[model samples]
Target chain A: MTESAAAPSGPGSTAASPEVRRNPVSTHPIASLLIGLLLLASIFFALYVPLYGRLTPKVGAWPFFYFYLLAFMPVMAVVLWVVTLLQRRFDTEAGGPR
Target chain B: MSHVNSTVFTIVVAVFILVTGIGFAASRWRRTQDMMHLNEWGLAGRGFGTFITWFLLGGDLYTAYTFIAVPALVYGSGSIGFYAVAYTIVAYPIAFIFLPRLWSVSHVHNYVTPADFIRGRYGSRGLALSAAVTGILATMPYIALQLVGIQAVLTVMGVGADTTNTYLKDVPLFVAFVVLAIYTYLSGLRAPAAIAFVKDTIIYVFVIVAVFYIPAKIGGWSHIFGAAQTHFTSTNPATGKPFGTFLPTTKKVGSTQLDFVTLALGSALALFMYPHVITGTLAARRRGAIKRNMSLLPAYSVVLALIALFGYMAVADPATVASVKKTGNAQLSVPYLFQNHFPSWFTGVAFSGIIIGALVPAAIMSIGAANLFTRNIFKEFFKPDATPRLETRVSQWASLVVKLGALYFAVELPKTFSINLQLLGGVWILQTFPMLVGGLYTRWFHRFALIPGWLAGMAYGTLAAYNTSSPTASHWASSSDIVFGFSLYIGISAFILNLAISVVLTLVLRAFKVPEGPDETLPRHFTVEATDTPAKERASVTAGEARPAPGV
Candidate 1:
């Protein structure tokens, strides 16, 4: 565990100790931006009613409204996983302990 | 009472006994050296890893109510019930944004509850007290809702007494509550975390089997949906309106598309703010564990979506619908549907799953409430020099008191009252969002300003909820209220009012040069993760020395 701390620290850590590795979200703007956009897209997809609330299209005996919401669960899992991965890029870039 | 299936009842009893044993034994499951601290009792030592945290949170968020009531709503209404699914889906991304920060800051400062963080950030015990009180209030109904879930299962099982006296009628529920209280007292948060594994597995197995097997046994998915559509479209003789909506309607005056959107959004915002959810989050091992679980926890939401389909299944099966209508309780739709469709032994499994489902979350909720009382109320106000052992002891006894308060809610009140109170609990808890979540990212909002903002949100939410009524009840009938001819979730509307008040008051307070309370946190503190050894040191140190500044 101590050996894993040998990473270039980001700005989050003020101690400047050799053992302390910073969390990357504090210094990585791109990661924060990507995560911010993903959050917005997620909220939009969830809250936008007219987009998928219609009943014409049915998938596998389920109404489009129900299917759209159900499908968004897995899609949300994937998008959040992508965000986690994007955040991970900062961890690797800063060589911080994950 | 209807005929009790001996086989099903016997199996459920057996499973209940098995879980009770596990709950008692969990005290030593992940044994820490010092067991008398609040960290061990209230948060399972705050050392839960990714896998354990996953199961624990999955079991925490998706409770017996989600299993029973979401489907019950779908059976009663229609597409509006699917708002639960949307709320859960959106809840993840929202949690993804704030939970890591919360975990990090709490970990660094050894904050035990959200109110502890509030007190530290805003330097106001008054604000912290408000948050603490709201958490406990919101949590009691939620815990009672879990009991209602158990009652629905027991009622369907023919075990509930058909008597005039409430105590005689609720003997089974009381017995279950006693066992839960004992085990939770013995094991604390570990009791729930350990038992969550069994509860979730049974739920998954039964829900998956019921999803595939029951539809085929009744008719098909197409047949079920078609029946639901037809039934909901037909006019009811009593009210002269359709039974429910096949899809969310734009033309409707009350239950329109906007209500659906607001309900979903409001519920999503309220989900993570609940004290039990925060307890689960704060118990995780690392910052990354929280993030990983957030991305992964929506798998349970998929299960929830499938569970919601059972409402349509109940609609498709005429016998189940008839039985539920005969009882005048839509909450029994899922249990009756399961009993009618599955074999006696499988019915036992499903019933036990729901009952155990209630137990896990109830234990967690009581613990959350107890922690608030111990940390924010008891220690903060009355006992300044309380020791770690005393805190844990007080929290243990406090968990019992909290459970009994929830029991009063479940027994004394009507089921509709309890359910609506749970919704009202959502509205009340969401008022804390600006102060708790806002404090995480910024401290610009004056601490004094937040107090009035909280007051405004609480007053508006309570009055609006009190004024709104359905045909059945007078006060706290529904969570949404009409605003500008559009029905909106009261939580969202109140939250908007809360933020607007806070912003205006903050500017005024700033101009008048009101002294902002000392912010003990640095920016870097929000991103720090706990090292294994330092976690123990911090836990012991904070347990001994932590106290809010005097006379804030």
Candidate 2:
């Protein structure tokens, strides 16, 4: 069952790997790199506690730590939004997902 | 009874009934021809677009855990509690890397649970069972924690029976659980998916109101932070140290910067791995919905950051502090803050949101755990010939059983015990990362090796968590322990150990030429979108795919 079901030929050839075979990254390396960097930047900024974990640099009444956390969410939303667009463009250029 | 406000109690009860009615009506929301199939019942027909998916996943993720526990932690421990905000922020980017792949594969193969994908990819029922068991075991305590959240709100409202008997006192909790189970049984995934709209609406309304109004009422953000800093830095008569950190320091003990970073990163990795979160993810109609949600869901974290500040708000308001100090449970801090500051009617609305917040996630969680049981354990081992109808029936029954178990955990065990187990749940679920997430990118890790690696990590995580102690408690006291003299989250440490063993054993298994389990999935399965293959095409292409061992 496992052996035979795995080799499904009809939908397998058409729906699955056409874009992957063309390799979206190889064709649009800069877009892929930007997406990667944007994602990494989002994670890096949030995880690096020391960068925002201070007391003095206050925004309004919030300490720097508190202010930074509240501020970081919108920035991350925008970063991921950009990454999504890049991936969409890259995937479309590489013969699209559908 | 003396403490109960009739107005608040009536309002809360009314809102709860309205939400319950919504839950019962949800079965018809996205009507499907066959409600008995696992995909329809368990995964909401796998047809949720970006909008509903956002609400479902947000309601699933933010939870009562966000509403009550995080504020309570911040109230008690100070800056360390903000790890939750950091965790939610980083979790999106981390999930963005892999969740869409999981979605695509699950969509292509009609997989309803993470364990189903593991079983299909690794071709090892044993490995799949481990993933399934871990998912159920981990989810039980989480569902229990939501009950704890509900109980806290009831306790604050002075709503439960005045009886000295423990079970009699929890009449309200039992009532809540029964309604939840019935609606979930009748409506399946659609029930929670529908109620999530109401849950999130009430939550956003209350949280935004509280963030703005509470601060304005209690002076302002500066005053709240200043009061919190003063209170936290002051010496505690019990411990002879400061109450907690006003700001996380580079010091060796108590909410260090290192501990903060590790907790954030570790929890970010573990968040989406939970079966309930994956259940929410796989329900999306398109893979792109998952990616878009990865960016969109952080909007909730903004509210989470505001909610965490409620701890400081509680500290800043003396009436709230005094009320909570009398109870001696930090969990009451946020509830007391609301009761003390808000008008009776608004307090009722906020309390209802808290109760319903617990319900939405609890429903999703029970369904997720049930799917894992039905797909990987029941059908895999007992009834391989079970029809889709039978699978959905088993899942519905299993969800009821899971909720009952959670009810027992919440009512019988000490609250601290459930809290400790939830912490361990985070650790236990991370052990499945090697198999679930690893198999997504590559199948290089030998399937046989994953079992022992998982076992070793589970064993070490359990014993280590057991040995951890705080000043007030001797066991199950903390989620982070010293590793190489650095305070690190046990989940991250156990995950590293699990990965190391997996790598070493894979090398050994490869050298011995052991048969790698059949790779049932092709690379294309990981990239396929729903529109890529029409339903008729998918059905014909993988004819009899749902039947047990059909090709054989």
Candidate 3:
């Protein structure tokens, strides 16, 4: 890391290079992909079961739309955690990948 | 004006004064030798790391628009309004993929706005100016919408009780804006950056408590859910349509599961494209902070999801619904609900929470608009050798003027109409997708082709949105219009048109010898490792904060 008063600092590294580095690999991927699939199911139920003309019995005291949406949050979060892990290829260094 | 109790008003004023003092002092926060440069004024010296970035970006993102408008839409529309929730859920994964790359490239080039990237990438100031103009124009009304959010709180708080005159009704709002304008003018980005800490804390406390306490008071979760379901299923007397669907459907009404998914996807793609979010991201010290913040941001989204449910709570309570109907102001549903249910002190806390919620993002939006004006408009066309101090000065004044203009929008425009205009804003903002986000992954679209494509999209979106009307108001009331048999949000349809034109024109232009601009940015610039590059490398970066008084 030579100092050049006129050399450009590449975008992000000028800040902290903290001691506890983030692992490039996340906890899970296949699970994350599967979760995304499950989420589509949940979101569909949220939409179809409530909005569709004469669907099925509602989820709880809760209607399908309300029930599925609240339930979808945790599932969505899990899937995002997974997608993020899979997409770790993008957040890597300027020279790391094309 | 009972809700604006004299005691609370005094306290709010004193706190605002104290906060303003702290804000003006923030010019010196994390002190550097000089404070006149645009970097210091606009990006807060660009030295923020993760912790501060979280609060700052959080402040910039979850705005008064989300707090007031989302709940109102939910209250009025029944179920379709929750698209905001889904859009928010998807925004993170969407941002996680590209934001870090943007951070790297913008940092490397010292680009101040998204337009800066366009200008550098394609060597076209016209294209850059188009993007900048689009961002600023869309954002002005947005800032105004935040003002309307504050005014709704004020109107509910009884701050405007004495006056039928519009000017008098907005007195409290006017005072807040004046103070906000001054602090933002003096402190620049630091004003919002510091105030975000206070705003987020107030919001988290009041919202968490309200989410719990309100449900119990309304006869628990079961009763709340039951009431909402019953209400949505009932056919409206006016339209004979059930209020709205709480969920998506396979059956197409121009609106379907596909519409839901596409709107979510389109908005998720467009979220960070707004110049303000980029300004917030670039101010951070490293790329990792942006990545880390994406996961952490859902913590706020959880709060937002609860906030949306406030709409359901409003729907379930018959008295609250009766009151909203009497006033014909659904925007006051949350404010009225709090007033009726919560104790005075807690209501004040909640009141301050929503008011400050509007304040934080209002500051950021104005600053983002000002940056566009200074960088793309002022610098590009005016004195190319404009001093950093001059640019900063012009931006400061521009921010004050923008807020004042938005203030007029809030006070002067009818509430129902302003909301429709906000939908109009959603339409105009989506037009920029081709240049800002599309160009990130590929440059296959020629810049020449892209410009006309952008214009076509803007015209179609504006006209389609303008023509959209319902029984409630003449022009801007309805969000859905049938397009080719499917009910859809106008923004998505318009964006598809924009992309189609750009793609077709790109192939056509390539057939001739329309030269593509030099690519100063390489593929790696989009994926730079944070720790791998040292601050020492930046020593030669000519874009470093130039001296204030001299010719920059």
Q: Measured against the native two-chain assembly using Cα atoms, what DockQ does each of the candidate structures obtain, in the order listed? A: 0.42, 0.61, 0.21
The better candidate by TM-score, 1 or 2, is 2
Candidate 3's docking class is incorrect
* Tens digit per residue, CA lDDT, model 3, A1-98: 12223223454334344122333333345544554565455445433433532324566566555555556566656655555555555334312422
Tens digit per residue, CA lDDT, model 2, B222-249: 8999999999999999989999898778
Of models 2 and 3, which has the larger DockQ? 2
- CAPRI accuracy category, model 2: medium
Runs in model 1 deviating more than 4 A are A1-27, B162-164, B540-552
Superposed Cα deviation of residue B11, candidate 2 (Å):
1.5
Better structure of 1 and 3 per DockQ: 1
Can you write out model 2's per-residue Cα lDDT over A2-87, one digit (the tens) per residue?
34334555454555445345656678888888888888878888888878889977777788999998999999898888888878
Q: Give lDDT tens digits, candidate 1, residues B115-142.
A: 9989878878999999999999999999
lDDT of 3: 0.75
Chain A of candidate 2 compared with the true chain A, TM-score: 0.80
Could you give the C-alpha RMSD of every candidate to the true structure, in order shown? Answer: 4.0, 3.0, 5.8
Tens digits of per-residue lDDT, candidate 3, B174-267, equal 9888988988998889988998888889889988999889988989888886777788778899898888655566677734676666666666
True contacts kept of each: 0.71, 0.78, 0.22
State the TM-score for model 3: 0.88
**What TM-score against the true chain A does chain A of each candidate get?**
0.67, 0.80, 0.39
